[model samples]
Target: MARSARLAAQGLAIGLVVGLLTLLVWRVANGNGKGVAQALADGEHPTAPAFDLSRLDGRGRFDLASLRGKKPIVLDFWASWCVPCIHESRRLEAARKEYGNRVAFIGVDTKDFSGDAREWQKKHGITYPSVHDGSGSVLTKWGGLPIPRIFFVARSGKVVGELIVEEDLPRYLREIAAS
Candidate 1:
């Protein structure tokens, strides 16, 4: 009985160690586990990175540099395969309508097929322009991971906030517009 109990304890200990190691590996692989929340918490509101990409609809090119000093800009990083983005899409369209010309809403469709992204936007009735980030260069530039990451930028081109939850976006948009 004593030997059996010792063996059981050893097995448990090994399992625990393996579990911890797996978690650590997963976290490190996924943006170092410092997502949008951590970026905001760091209190370093960096300048919004400038990018130029083809429009998702293939209409024309979308340039971030042109938006500087124009108005508050909301950059939403999303992918069609991402479930959360489907829900967030509705909120974004609503916010865009609510704000109505006071802010510029841009969607960055990252790591997704252009046709799929375009279809997704069409299904969601997204009127705001979206750019295809097929290479994920824009995502890396903004240090964003995980779909549905929203970055709020002031008129001065400085990032004001980073949000993952959709509910908080409207309030942030209202405040940014008012300011």
Candidate 2:
């Protein structure tokens, strides 16, 4: 009877350990996608990863570190095929037009053809430069997630904010400017 009880206790302990591990993995994988405004409202600061990608123009490569000396950089990871990305392109073009020198805006086209990205930019009048992430190398470094993601980096090269929605963009940009 004692041996059976000991086995049962061991099983319970193992089950509890497995449950805890599963919970931890779930939390890590299911990150708080609660757009930037909501995260800020709850007092959270989202960070962006270091970025270095080749330019679509083929003129030169762009490294996040290179922009450190200049104004804050805003990066949008998107694709022409993404419906929401289409809307985001329009919004970013406006921001680029209004705050041209105040900030450096860039777009990273993920898993998309260069021609498609170029066409999308031309159609929307996007003045900012866009880099290609066809191999998803930059995306993996930037926390491999879905498209239409925005990362706001400070002038010092540190990421200060991350937003996942086009609707929350205006407020997110305002907050970034304030910060």
Specify the highest-lDDT model's number.
1
All-Cα superposition RMSD per candidate: 9.2, 6.0
Model 2 per-residue lDDT tens digits across residues 38-100: 454466654445567789888788876777656777888888888888777778888877766
State residue 160's C-alpha deviation in candidate 2, in Å.
1.9
Q: How far is candidate 1 from the true structure (C-alpha RMSD, Å)?
A: 9.2
**Which segments of candidate 1 are over 4 A away from where they belong?**
1-39
TM-score leader: 1
- lDDT against the true structure, per candidate, is 0.82, 0.74
Candidate 2 CA-lDDT value:
0.74
In model 2, the runs with Cα more than 4 Å from the true position are 1-48, 165-167
TM-score against truth, every candidate? 0.75, 0.68
User: How many backbone clashes can be found in candidate 1?
Assistant: 0
